[model samples]
Each structure stands twice: as structure tokens, then as C-alpha cells.
Target: MTRTRTALLCAAALLATTLQTTTATTAAARHEQRCADTSDTRRGEARRVMDIVREAHRDLGLKAALVRVTTDGREVVTGAVGESMAGVPAGTDMHFRIGSVGIAYMGTVLLQLVDEQRVGLDDPVSRWLPDLPHGDEITLRMLGSSTSGLHDYVTDPDFLAQLDAAPFRQWTPRELVAFPLRHPLWYQPGTNWSYSHANFVLLGLALEKITGTPLERLLDERVMDPLDLRETRNSFTPQIPQPVLHAYDDERGTYEESTFWNPSWTTAPGAVLTGDICDLARSARAIGAGELLSRRSYRVQLDPGTVGLPGPTDTCPADVCLPQTEEFHFGVGVIVVNGWVVQNPSFSGFAAVQAYLPSERLAIAVSTTVDQDGASGNTAQRIAERIADALAPEQPLGG
Candidate 1:
């Protein structure tokens, strides 16, 4: 989940309380999580990982690089490199906005509800949002699979212009959905593949209405609670918790700290989330493994019929309507590359990636912020792919 035009999920086993805890309380929670994995003595691997991180941090001019690598739920390495502010060092446990991790969580929630028979993936969302234009033609499956054909509001020129003009604006869900509706459907619903934040935003709304639960509580109960992500949490404001790993960007033609920039337009409101690297890796494991869904639902989560959607059409640009293939494609909210499931979110100077190789039970999570005048991009993703290549060369990860 990223802002392709600009920039671009969960609680513990909450899918969490509002993460307004004092610094000490958050530390205690982190300690408890660390105590659960005490047998991780992979020094050799850890050293290798540290070297990789150091090289990336330096090469990419990252202000801070927070990372966690785990094998079968055991820590292989966890670290933070560089500074959080002028002279303050960043810590591994510092919390950062998880970006599109919420997308995966939202998708997971959809499947969890599906597994419980609360709703069918094929059920039309018109069942809930009766007034949604073309709701009858758009199925929950299409929404979660990003085949809904709705234009990604994040890519709309007007949306980006507004965002650029007012980075601190508190955007409403209806406002975000309005951007896509302003344009005709990208293609017939469910007949093509395109990454649209509108799909997830709409899904979040429909889900809330379907269960009479807010997206925050719904995700915590169904997804985060089961995963036990103590550090993961939802925030109503742009306020990231203490020991925050601050982010910087030059997108506005000025290098500045974007740590508190309102990210409401990124996705649905209640679903915006933040967490530490450890929780990020844990999230990769849970969502990638489909740990909370039934076997049938898990299988569907991995491949929800997007394996070979028709290629980009005239109405759909090739870059926007990405090609879906076996090695690389969209699966629900996650992106599948080789055999790794990934969610990479980059926006407002913060970039992160959580990737899991289900077959190997290996997970890699990385988050980074740019230094003043640093090269700008999703550097975190490039780092994770490199790590995946090093750890599982036989089954390389990436597009």
C-alpha cells in the first residue's frame, strides 16, 4: 500500500488499545514480546543482517533504518540504525506508521469474516452500502482482490494536488471514495486487476456496516488479537507513540520532518496503524501464513483468482493496471512476489515493508526514513528484497 502518485494494518493476537500508552508502558509490552522468543541465538545470521542493514542505511542515506528478521517466529536479528532527530538515536523498538500493513490487515479481516460465514466473499457490497454506485456489480471478493475497477484516488491528479497543498488536512472516508466516483469505472468490476486504495477504503466501510463494528475493533478482535501483536495499534490522530522513529522527505521541494503529517487520505480512517519492527515481522508471519483463517479461506487468501487477469486495456494504463502472473501478482491485500507475500508502503518520507515466505516460515520487516537531501523512494522494499535473496537464495523474493 503506497501512494504511487505521491507516497503511500493491526493489534496483537487487538488486531490493541489505542496506543496512547506512556513510554514505560510501551516498553513493558515490548519486553513481554521479547521474552516470548528467548532461544534465538543466530549470531552468524544476525551479523550478516546487521552488515546488510548498515550498507543499505549508508547507501540509501537513510536517517533511520529499523529492521527485524525472523525465522519460524524466532528472531534472527533486530536493530535500528541512524538518528530519530537532530542528535537523538533511533531505537529498534521505536514505533512508525505501518502504511499499507493496514491493507493486508483489512484483507485478512475480510477473509476472517468469510471463514466465519458472517459474509461471503462473493456477496455484493450493495447488501451493506445500498447507495454505493454500482454496489450490486462489485463483490467483496472484487474489493479485497483490488479488482473492483475503481480508480485509486491516491493517483488522481486532484487528490494529489489537494494532498500537496494541504498535507495536514483531515480527510474523511466519503471524501476519499468521492475521488474515484468522479471518474468512470476503470473497467467492468471484477473483470480486471488494478491496485486501488478506494477498494480497501470501500471494503473497510462495508465491513464496518456489515458487523456494526468500527474497523479498529473489528480488526483487533478478528485479526490482531489472534496474532498477539502487542506493539501494533490504531491511532485517530497523526501522533505516533513515544520513541518514535521520525521520518523525513523532500517531496515538497524542502527536506523536512513528516513524522506527524496527517495520513488520513492514505486509506480508511479507523484502519490507520503504527507499530515497531518486531510487530511488523510478526504481522508478516500471521497474515502471510493466514494463521487466523480457515484452511479453505487461507488458500483463497493466497490466490483469489487474480493469477491471470486480462492485461492492461485502453482505459487502463499498463503501469496502473499491473499484470498479474504466477511469480508476481496481487492476492487479496498482499502482493505476492516469487513465493513471498509483501506489503510495502511509502509516503511522506516514511517507507516500510513486511515480507514473509510462508514455505520457509521466514519473515522480514524493514522501515526507513530519508536523511536531508537523501535519495527518495521506497528504499525499505529494496532492502527487504536483498535480505530475502541472501537468506533464501534458492527461493528468491522480488518482482
Candidate 2:
């Protein structure tokens, strides 16, 4: 029997292929889940979790955010919590830097172009942007997969100083590319995997060269507008609009206010978007159903599973490593968490997770602005697991 929340859930549900439902016992046992009709139940759980985290997590700040879940095109939960800042403003639609998560989404958009023959996956960087070292050797695929051998600009002391001094500065792809383009390859392209924003920065420039449009415009028209994601957008300018979240940095012993210019430097590397729980849930579902790309293009984004790439914690000897995967390899744009979950987090002030049970056509998205220990993937995983367990039909994990 469909519950009252089903209709509300449908409004926010993103498209996805149908999933088969197994016996409730099997569904419940396979994952830490619980069947409930009350969206309030999930919200309460998130609130409770946040209270504990805020008081104890190493990172002491938080932001306004929401979580949404859907099953077979039906919305299950939509709730926002916390204020953007202690006294400034509050809303579910506020935007924040998506950090590395932007890279994954960038890969998805680029692959879609490849699917349409608008571009090619194996195309060299030089084909689009000329006058760069190793332009002939670095391919789009290698850059997306983190095997491009480009050093990250963010690690440089000068880069960090600039970022700190001007957190709200708007930057262009050409300006951002200069950093890594000037450096020697950290390793042979395709020989290793390293997570560097520089790879995606270059990719963003290539995308501009291919489309003849700014990254923001292409992303908005192709991804957000089609989905009717009113609350999600790329803030290219330094002036943040209303209902924005205020970020903070613990500098030495003082907490300093920080603002992320969603466009400028971060662009394709990790900055083209900000969204609420509802839109994000819809986006995840759409991507999973192959709505954003053709089956061929979608396959490229999901290839981390088949290629068996090593992660940061993987037992690989190379400098570039695969992320630890208890389930499958990292897919193209997102990590395949525990065989079912997919998640992305920004270093700024937000983190998000999504998962689907193919058999049941059930999916869930959890997001938070809470930061834990310098954007540690391990911390994000723990938070994701907490929410996943609650959504599971079985008892929450751990006694």
C-alpha cells in the first residue's frame, strides 16, 4: 500500500530504471534499513546524529543542508537542518563548493559529449588547448580517472595563500590551468592515479574549447535546467546571493569566516554546483538511470568497477592509488561504496551520499554541511553509513 508520503516523494524523485523488490527479509538483511512511512523519522535521525557530531567531531562548524530519498520514482524523505551560519540566514537551497565531487560530475558531463560524438574519450588535451606541456600525452580519460600525472595546484604554498587571501575571487579556466601546466608531470600519464584538481581544471578548459561556452552555461543548460533544479546552481561571481551558507576555517587558534566562489577557480575541478537535498536526490536518480548520457557514455563513468583501479588505501605501489572499496572499484565519477552506495563531498562545508537497491528500485541521498577532519573520506563514509543503516529495512548497523 502506498503511504501518504509517496505523493510528496514522487514530486522530488529523479528518474531511474525500475528495481525488483525481493522478500522483505532479504531486503532488510542485505542492508541496514527500516521500513517507515514517516519522513519525519529520518529527519529526526539526522538531527540526532548531527547533535552528537557537532559536539564531538574534530571539525567544529556546520552549515544548512538537507537529505532526500526516493524509491521507484517515489520520494521518501525531504528535510533540511541547521542554519547556514549562527545568525546570518537559513534555507534549503543555499549553495556551497562541491570540492572533488565536482570532478566526478565533470567527468559525467564530458562523457555525455563523447557519447554524442561532440568529443572523444581518448582525445588528447593538445587537440583543444594548445601550448601546454604533455598536452600530447594526457587524454581526457586519464584526467578523469586521476591518472594524468599532473600535480595539483592546491598543494602549493602560494596557491593556498592566494586562496586564503581571496576566497571569493572569480577565476577562469586559463588562470587555473597555469599552475599544473607549468609543472612537470608527477608521473607518466596513465601509469599512475593521483587525485588532483589540476586534472579537472584542464578538463574544464578543454570543455570550454569544445562547446564554445562557459562551463557554468553548459552545466546549467545540460544538467540543472533540464531537471528543473531551481535550487542548484554555479555561483561564478564573488557576490553570494541570499540564503547562502557561511563557511568557516580554523586558522591557528581563531575561527575565520570564509566564502567559496562557486565558479572561479573551482569550476570543473570541483565548483560548478550547489543544491538542496531534493534536487540532488533527483539528479542522482537521473544519472543512475542513464538519463544524462547514452548507455555507452554511462559505461565510461561506471568503468572503475570493471577496470579494478587501485584507491588511496589500495595495496598499490604507485603514487596515484584507488580509493578503498569494500564493494567494487571506484566508478568513473563517484565511488562505489559497499557495492550499492555512491557519494560525493566538497571540502568546503558539505558532503553527500546516494545509494540504490536495483532489485527494489529504491534509492537514497544523504547530505550534510558538517566537516570532519580536513575532508577525510573516512569521516564521510562513517556519516553515510549512519544514514544508510537507518534507511535500510533492517536494524541500524552496530549494536
Candidate 3:
């Protein structure tokens, strides 16, 4: 082989390598473009949603943002932006604490029992949880509807002080409920509407007593599996699954990772959960559609007799016992803002929302972790509100 012939072979090999590199780069760009909108069916609106998410990420000073919007069970746009940790890109599949979404799920389970004739909506809590104070007066409907009139234990000053003192302490349902029970009822049971963690916590206990099953296992077999929410699993402790979306907050005077903070006090033991954005969207649709409930049970879940309640009295402050009107009222475990069924939960440093517009069957779910001085407490819900405005202007979501 002469020098000229050898040089010609080397040049040909170099050209082939360059072409391969170019092709790879082009394919990568196309992949990114494809993810801009989840499906080709609604390219126009999905792109607008992607723009909203990017803008929110920048403006809100978010460390990570995950969103999924769907119409009629189909994806409009699903995306994740920012980092779970420095140098680690966020993804829609990473799990974060779902916060109050579990309350909605528990409500669904109670309705299921009603459908099965195992329990009646009006049955006194005394029937299942006779040990509870005022159990006879507080019925199942009241418990699920947040009209039980028990003050929210979360609002109690002592509970807040203890929580701040030991952020990682594991709390039992009874111990948490004690905070509210120690104080007198804000008003007679079932007289008006007021948010109360004790209602749900006691409801969880009643459910376990009635069903003779652990809430964790029951949720998996009934709600999570049936709805195809594979990633929505109850945590016994602070553990999150692999690919965790690390969270940070400045609540203790400095920004610190709080991903592993014990959330046992957030709700019932088996109901504390973590999930990715996709499951969050699916949950919104399930609750919005009443997919698992019978016609009668579903109707009650939406209204639950809270509407037309007389406005708050002297004992119950107007703010605490807010009026229950058709437009913006408490519907069982969820909130009805306009026509959107919603739950927005902020726990530790994690914030998330699951909002569904029943009229259009549109579901928007967002989960976020904020920077030290970034967005407000419920930044995920704020992002969802903007998406709802852009996609379904006629039926806006607010709380």
C-alpha cells in the first residue's frame, strides 16, 4: 500500500464517522420536538401548555416542575423541567409525596362501601368507631364531607409546635386526632362546613374497623390498581421509591433537602403516598369522572348535602365555617371551584395539584419543589390554574 492510497482510505473512514454523528444529533433534536406535545391529536393546545410550564418554571423560581394535562383520558401535554438534584434532570417518572390526594381516594373507598351495601351514608360514626367522642352525632356522610364541625388538628397551635420541634417524628392517627378532640367542637356536628384533618383521620379508623383490612392494602387492591395508578403507593415511613424527586425548603431558616421528612402526621398511616405526575393526572380523572362509583353514590360524592347550609354563626367564625354554595363548595373529599374538582396539597417542600374539569373531561396535574425564596406554598396548583385557563377558559379552576 502506497502513502497516497493509505491516506485516501483514512479520509473515507473519517467522512463516514462525521455523517453518523450528524444523523445522531438530528434524531435527538426530533425526539425533543416530539415530546413538546404528548400526542399529535392536540398539537396546538399541547404546545401552548408546554410554553406555560417553561414560563412557570422560570418565573416561579422552581427547582423542579412536572406536569401532565389530559383530555378524555388522553395526554395533551406531559413534561418535567428542572432538576431533582443538581446535575440530575427532572423526569415525569420521579416520585414525590402526593399530600392530600389520598383524602380524595379515601372518600372514593367510603362511597364504594356504600354502593356494596356494607355501610350506609347516614350510618352514625358510633356504629363503626363508637370509642370516638361524639361518634353518634358525627355520621359517615359528615366525616367524608368535612362538615363534621371538628376543628382541623393541623390548625392547632400545640400540634404545630410539636411538628416544628421534631420534623421527622412519626405520628399516629389517634395522637394527631387528640389535638382536635382536646378542644370543644367548633360547632354542633354536621351543622356547617369546616376543614378538619380529624374527620379524615377518624374516617380512616372507622374504615379499618368496618372492613377489617389495613388501609394500605385496601387502597392498593381497590383504588390504585383499579385506576392504573401503579406509582401511587402508601409509604410506611419517609421512604420514596427509586428515582426520587428530592425536595428542598427554607422553613427552618435555611434551604435544606426535606425529601425524607416523615409525613406520617400528614394523614392516616397507610394513606401517606408518593407518585409521579402521570398517576396524579389519572387520579384527577377518576375522581372527576366518578368512574368507580354508582350513579347514586357518585351524586352524593359531588354534593354531599353541604350546599345551602346556613352561613357561619357566632361560635363558628365565618372564615372557618365558610358558606357552602353550588359554585365553590366542599364536595365530599374534594373542592369544587367553579366546575373543577380539585385537591392542592403542600407538605414539607413538595407542592402538587390534581384538578379535573368535569364538563370537558380535562385533567391537569402538577408537582413542584421550590427554591428558598421562590413561589408560594401551592406553586403546583398555581401552575395548574394557568394551564386550565389556557386550555379550558370557559371552566376555570381556582380554590
Q: Which candidate number maximizes TM-score?
A: 1
For 1-399, candidate 2 gives per-residue lDDT tens digits of 387588757754532212223343454342222222333344555465454444324443345445555766565555455666666544444545444445556777788788778877788989987777888998878777667777777766677787767666666767776777677776677765566777777777787788888877777777777867666666555545444566554432345555553445654632466655556666667666556778777666766333544444433335445543445545556555444535466544445555554444556655555432344333434554565565564532222
Q: For candidate 3, lDDT tens digit of each residue in 260-281?
A: 9999998877889898788898
Give the clash count for each candidate.
19, 19, 0
How well is each residue in 158-217 modelled by candidate 1, as lDDT tens digits?
998998888998999899999999989989998889889999888899889988999999
TM-score on alpha carbons, each prediction: 0.92, 0.72, 0.89
Task: State the weakest 10-residue window (summed lDDT) of model 1.
Answer: 7-16
RMSD to truth, every model: 9.6, 12.5, 8.3
User: Where is the poorest 10-residue window by lDDT in model 3?
Assistant: 30-39
Give the Å error, residue 141, model 2: 1.2
Model 2 alpha-carbon miss at residue 190, Å: 1.4
lDDT ranking from best candidate downward:
3, 1, 2
Candidates' lDDT values, in order? 0.86, 0.59, 0.87
Clashing pairs in 3: none
RMSD (Cα, Å) of candidate 3? Answer: 8.3
